[model samples]
Target: MSKSLLLLFVAVFCINCSSDNKESDTPPTEEPLYFPPLTGTTWKTKSVESLDWNKAAVQPLLDYLKLKNTKGFIILVNGQIVMENYFNGHDAATNWYWASAGKTLTSAMTGIAQQENLININNKVSQYIGTGWTSTPIDKENLITCKNLLTMTSGLNDATDDVTPSALTYTADAGTRWAYHNVYVKLQDVVAAASRQTWSAYFNTKLRDKIGMDGSWFASGNNSVYYSTTRSMARFGLLMYNKGKWNDDVILNESYFNEATNTSQNINLGYGYLWWLNGKASYHLPQSQASFQGSIIPTGPNDMFMALGKNDQKIYIVPSKKMVVIRMGEAADNVNLALSDFDKTLWTKISALYQ
Candidate 1:
């Protein structure tokens, strides 16, 4: 072997080795988010330090919530509890009302029912619930569909205080209007009739039992409301954070879950089927005719969508951060049935804590 030939061969080998080293040094991709299994009363947990969070900063956020009538609060990252708090004698065992936050649960169950081929959301409400479900005549009632109920676009006159069929009169075609009305209760009935089971029974079977959630739905006059422990609410937020999955089980359909959390109608960019979404150009507050000019929760994550309810029940999900936060308690501010200024203040405090 000549010296020149050997030197050239050595340089070629060196080049190949450098290329291989570069390929192996590329950074590994981040781990995909995961959820805990639905098993015993205890759920998996993670420390704030696991995410490099400043623990000292969390106390101010807690103190603020305590002063603002909050009873229960939980924040989960990657489906593990990072913070679970209760105030005013409310503890892990206390079951509280989800208020309109339960609307998100109903929407999920509706999606599951549709997934099971029980009833299509786009189908007319009269089809499953039978005719005369609404005060509207045959022609008008035919225009009102299950989707309308879900989207709060049923076009029924929400001006009336009474919830009867006659009081829930039709003033316009379905899908043409968005009003936060108690007429949403009819959706549960529609699901019930279509599934041949009561709303509570179906929900208990399809969702609660499947997710190890111990919650009960009870009648509150014209509405059916849900009551559950703060952890149960956190479990629900986790199920949604994983995009409708409970560990290995696919409890809610993926495609349906996406639509359920994103904007569902042109009228309200921050409202999905029944959930409240954040990071939209604008949003509408319940019982208000005006559409505000910003995300419902300005300080929360841009990707966070929420289940906000009357007198301040909340379930917040941030897919970008693999986070699910829940607030189940009394009113933080004198707001009606939707997002409030307190949402901004609390989230702003939380943002500081995570820094």
Candidate 2:
């Protein structure tokens, strides 16, 4: 109870409190932010000719969607936002569901694994997730591979949960035929198991870090991960346009990027790794039998490709044209709305600029 002792005690307490405050002030370490140099009036409305569209026409297409309730849409040309529009109270920053489009991210991770020498796409899924990766019948498990999952040719239909066998079983065998299903979902665990890191961690460190993607992982709790804002989706498309290179960094291995973007398997009309190819030869039809024909509207060349999602989350990459276009929003059950027409129309308006 002496004065000197009490004073010393008080001073020690104050120092401890100050130290705690300083520690609290320090920022948490996170993956650094990647701000791509993409902004300004180009994204805003401007003269069609001023922007370099082969034949830029969106008004008619916009008119077509006028009566429909949709989320948002963005259009970028040669890595620049040539046109952007929003609906349903959504904005550029809104995070819409990429659905199947997010699958491209998964496929991209596979490419990253190849770059790091984790595993090869030609490797069987069993090699990564172990034997019986799919909970399907015994016959189906033996035939699955990373390539099969990415190309949608795993031959195991998702009618019943492929993860949970209590659901249903549709087919067996690998290259017998093709049907779009959730069989590829199992690859998430396979990739994570092989890399020995959580899918989120692996993605953030491997892919997101390279391209400077700002989107968060959508499926956080259940081992499912997909995400992106319209702009982020555009950046992914641009990465593909740049052949998996961000600036000077080779984000994706050139060989893997080439095969992943090209038609890995011909199951669907146009399918590369998780990405989709759009060409006259593309035999796959949107849920609705939409046809994309014409020039001027932004589209992939005979070699053009795309990353398409369930709700119309699209990253269209055309190598020959040197163009990347991103469209994100609800397109009615992931159906293509005048996609063929839009591709043709936009190209017409954009083509004038090029000439």
Candidate 3:
């Protein structure tokens, strides 16, 4: 090649090299999502001004929460309590039932049980909980797996009020139907049977104590309910916000954590393992078989996932916003088994705060 041709090639090569170098020199794009220190009640906070939020927009949220009968409301920004309030005679030390939101905790404990190899979620429920755990025929009952319970696809009839295995009447085959059922609590039994420890003992040792969370499970008639201070609920949200890691301790395996938060089945795009997910194209409401279009909490950040419960109890984790928010109280407007209008309305007010 001629010297002129060689020079031309060299110029082109240099340009390409410069382009590659420029791309490489670009800084990492992820926002600084902060996590608080492990093993302490003391958590550092970031102010609205510091975080560039519209400071004046927060008061409206408090008023709305109060009007909606919210007992405890908390907002943890980057692992700190940016806002905390209690109303209706409720205080910080008060223990409130998580209701269905505690299902998320059950989901986490199931994942932990799987992580220890004490049980496999894919195994038949009968394998651990034993046959006749459901009223279905021997063969149909065998089809139910822990995964089905996690995904609320147990195929067990949920129209009835009974929550026991005998009352878990069969409808469709497992993995074929998705119906929100307390059959998820059966997971506690599975973990217990597999680990040879009661669900409360197993969960306390594996997660609660390890993360410095204060809570306990109590029998609520046919089902058990978890009660804890609002702050303790916030701590669990932060734990999940950090993907099951507390400082250096890996309380839950990251892979399982992802599975628990992401869409677990095709039936409900707005649901994970016992968690309500935002940004999905469609969602399903409890006690309803209809599938609705659009995100569950449309006003909230797209990446938010929540442990939502009856009477509007909520533990919302927004990864995109680096926040954990919780609300515990009586029914907001209406008594329901799970998510209500309060979710969207409250989030709309919250979005205004960030505006």
Candidate 4:
């Protein structure tokens, strides 16, 4: 062949090779975010479909608790869903407020801070915020420690302003007694101040995002409340179920997770770092006689933990059974509503299904 013709053919081959190389070096498109596998997908009910909870006895319990208006419920047993139901006008996408139930989340964040060496719950809270945390009588405030805040024994005069207290007076010596108040809410601010990040940012980057939880700040310090869909709440419960590991990722320090869920505080019979325990010792009613505090469903296993909100938002995690039961509803304290009894009944019915 002629030299010119050979050279032309060689140039074309080189060009083609380079083009192919470029194409190969270009990264392949990534797959979209992973959706968790659905095992009992058939049980997922639409708002229009009647739930399969067929026990005749369950209907009375539902009527008693007004489950018709329930937003959503997801029950998991041994990592498989035993039941998942969404009622009228509600679905997995709807974000629900955790209210005081969110306090459990705060406790989790505190453990995260300790893991990162940003703050220690055992340290004196006053040490991080200075002596201003001291009570009006001064000496009493010094006794207040970060542990008091975690355990809700800070002794701060939380009666007047629970959410945002401009002056946090250690009314009594810390660790002297127990009180369920918003004074502990201020610890979120203290945590943010110490960590130098907003509550939302810290939680999302550290906890939610890592755990694949689609959660947002529904509320905070009586002001910035966080909101999350029921599925997201379930994810948190599942994460805790595995001892701070979610989807094979360790989002919280295992040590902290154990400490948070374990019965640490003595004020509430079933209280822990911020989560509630399933001990019947804290029962306040006949409904709770079959149920327990600190979880959405009372019939859940005894080793369960929960994140409870004021409006009946709850995330219940039972490590022993590998179960998570989540419920979100409107208990606005409006219309003279009391949801605890209803919740107890709902749990009792759900427990029957597992049996």
Best by lDDT: 3
Model-by-model lDDT, in order? 0.86, 0.64, 0.88, 0.66
Clashing residue pairs in candidate 1 are: none
Cα-based TM-score, every candidate: 0.91, 0.73, 0.89, 0.74
Q: Residue-wise lDDT of candidate 2 within 56-102, one digit each (tens)? A: 34565455444344566555555555566777788877777777777
Q: Whose TM-score is higher: candidate 1's or candidate 2's?
A: 1
Q: What is the Å distance of residue 316 in model 1 from its true position?
A: 0.3
Model 3 per-residue lDDT tens digits across residues 1-355: 9999999999999999999999999998954545555456676666778778888888898899999999999898877778899999999889999999999999999999999999999999889977887778999998888999999998989886577767989899999888888778888899999999988999999999887788799998667899999988988998999999876689999999999999999988888988889999998888778999998877888899999888889999998777899999999986576777788899989888787
For candidate 1, lDDT tens digit of each residue in 138-197? 898899888888989988888864667778788788888788888878888888988999
lDDT score for residue 30 of model 2: 43
Instruction: Report how far residue 328 has shifted in candidate 3, in Å.
Output: 0.7
Q: Candidate 3 regions off by >4 Å?
A: 1-41
Write candidate 4's Cα lDDT for 1-355 as tens digits.
9999999999999999999999999998943222353232232222212333445654554453354466777766544455566776878677777667777788888888888898878777667777654445656766776778777777766565444435565556677666666667657776787889887788888887776577577544455566787777776777677787665566787888877877676545566786766744653221121323454345556777777766677787766655678877776234322235655656666666445
Per lDDT, what order, best first?
Answer: 3, 1, 4, 2
CA shift at 40, candidate 4, in angstroms?
Answer: 18
Q: How far is candidate 3 from the true structure (C-alpha RMSD, Å)?
A: 6.5
Off by over 4 Å in 2: 1-47, 52-58, 65-70, 135-140, 166-170, 220-225, 280-282, 285-301, 332-355
Q: What C-alpha lDDT, on a 0 to 100 scale, does residue 232 get in candidate 4? A: 72
- Superposed Cα deviation of residue 142, candidate 3 (Å): 0.7
